[model samples]
Target: MLDLRDHFFVPDAPAVELRAFTHGLMPKTVPAMMERFVEDWRERGVDAWNEVPNHWRPGSGEVVGWWTLPETLGDAFIAPLLGAPAGTCIMQPNVHWTVQCLLSAPEPFTAGRNEIVFSEGAFPSVQHSVYQWAAMQGLRPRPLPLGADGFVHVDAVLDAISDRTAWVFLSHVGFTTGEKLPDAALHAVAEKAHRHDALFCIDGYHATGSVAVDVEALGADVYVGGLLKEACGSTGNSYLYVRDGLTLTPRLSGWFADADPFGFQKQPQPHPDVRRRFLAGTTAIASLYHAVEGLRLLLDAGLENVRTDSLAKTALAIEQAEAAGLTLQSPREAERRGAMVILAVKDAAALCEWLKTQGVFTDSRQNRVLRLAPFVWNTTADIERTFAVLEDGLKTNAHQHVVAPASAGPVT
Candidate 1:
């Protein structure tokens, strides 16, 4: 009985977008909020920044008492949904920038144990960013294997850590395969990483708004996420959540990190605390305004509701894909998979292109797996239509993509 498709900026109906796992569809309210943002820039000008009853910038990422205003409202609402406490989550321009800040912070990594460990299945953007950082720092990049399971178990991942390990960072869900790093795995890894003196960080882009997150429950030291993919926000808006006590002096300093940012004193000392230390130069505030409504919409819908729907959609998708004689690369069990379903088929790129022609939007990765993700806006009808086309396409057998072998793993 629950449906939210009317609230979103849906594509012309029958145009099924099973692609929220890749990027989000916008909410209808965002345009109005963004228009107000532009109007503020035009009328109040630079006063807009100060106009928002400013929330105190504690050195750590936690927020304090309630405040009303546009700029801080997003974080106030968004932090809890993403598993971070208020004031503790600082919005950055994007995930790459946040990761850059994390790598630049020199506190966590020790002299001999400065290596970064993540699985090969990590989103390439994150893996490459860390790779570049490790190269520049002369630190080793320890990329472990995903193996035949198409997922790395928690104990195996923890076993990979050594005294020389500085950071253990990976996605909450495997981007290509849609395998989730569940709470048990997350907690176990966090505890072990702490015992080994390594900071446990999560690249939560795939998990944040799409699923339930409790940062404290997960015990992550640092967590980074973006609104672009799952929160129906414009690009250039993301966040980094730092735990309360750990001090990581960010070498990626800019005007925002200054003790007296607006004072023009040009202080050399970045905030010694985790909060402001990582905030670099001025951000595109308009992008953040657009993101707020999406978070608000999700919160209104209830995270647990979304989680329940996500599982239902995923289970249905897997069932449908199987019924279509498609081999699923994702786990059949709802508990093991994320919000998306990945199916192994040859000529995936061509198949995705063909599907686009039919108004069914999807994404392909690893040159074999086709990703179809259903979100709050999607209905059982949308999914039925999408697969019906797939069935129709296969029957035509014209320019069809053959199904690939089950043994094929993700190329990433």
Candidate 2:
């Protein structure tokens, strides 16, 4: 049995690790890369920004010669995996900034296109920012209702779009239930948004490293994500993938956004391409190193392989939960599931607290659903152990919920 738990630095190794979706257990490569990054800084000093060798080749994708330029980011390792064209993917520091940059683009929200549409199931931070964005733009955000099953329904989302829509955005995977929007469903949303002349954006934070993505096939105009969670990387390395040939001038400008970044030209003429007008300032070189290294590890190990094992882990989680009489809040179908399984209970907090005491790690949602996400680092035995602890915890009066429904099926 190939147990992946050993590859990571789990503080409690023998303890069940089902929390990768929240904080990915760092890989061995991260420290190695970071050490090398430090060495570069020590050896190269201020000049290391451009002198540190870039990994990309010239003329690789739709646009080439980025590495040859003065200021460059090597997060393009994600583009191929994301099915994004070269020269279109630029990694920012966080989702808030990425969203702001996307919204602030000159071409968007023009000519009566004032509405912003998203599902209420988006990550709370992202959901919060979009609402604030709506308020800032002087329009209310139109959020789609959660399905009766507590998941997102593509048809319902599409119906909410109108000609007045300026942007269509949603998490590629639902954070609460771990339900992945299928390719067909995503394409439908993209097509519908285009019909309304709206820009389609996918928040790929939960989807990027965990799910197999093909942005072209999904028809997303702009896709944004970060390596903080499932990608086994640290913060400060989030990305935004814009479709090729879409010209959007960035309203948020800095010296790094300059077309000639090194020239010190006071008059900023943004780079004519996707990188045009997009950069906060001097990027965190060390953080960027860890980001690429993490991607490299996943790429070397193979994303499809990671996804296959992820599916099995999640499936095993559901099976174990069901066997222990836990009610599933996430979908049952393999294709519809992401890396985690959400179990509905009366007291998610109680269950989590008990699990932690038992050396098992898991998180809760809305104080009711146990969000168990097993990753490559977990074993089937870990799943079994989690369920065992779960069964024991539920037996005690103190750990019991308000009232768990008699053994139920998926949330529907």
Q: Which candidate is the best by lDDT?
A: 1
TM-score of each model, in listed order: 0.90, 0.89
Candidate 1 off by > 4 Å: 52-74, 400-412
Lowest-sum lDDT 10-residue window in model 2 = 62-71
Q: Give Cα-based local distance difference scores for all models.
A: 0.76, 0.75
Candidate 1 structure, TM-score to reference: 0.90
Candidate 1 whole-model C-alpha lDDT, 0 to 1: 0.76
Global Cα lDDT for candidate 2: 0.75
Model 1 C-alpha lDDT per residue in residues 1-412, reported as the tens digit of each score:
2478888888988799888876688888777766766776787676666563222332456432211232254357657676666667776777777777888878877767888888888877678878899889888888888867777656668888888889998889887778888888889989888888999989888886778888889999988877776677767777778887878887887776777665778456776545667666675666666765677677778888888888888887888888999999887776677888899987777687778778989888766878988888888998888889987776786436543335566521
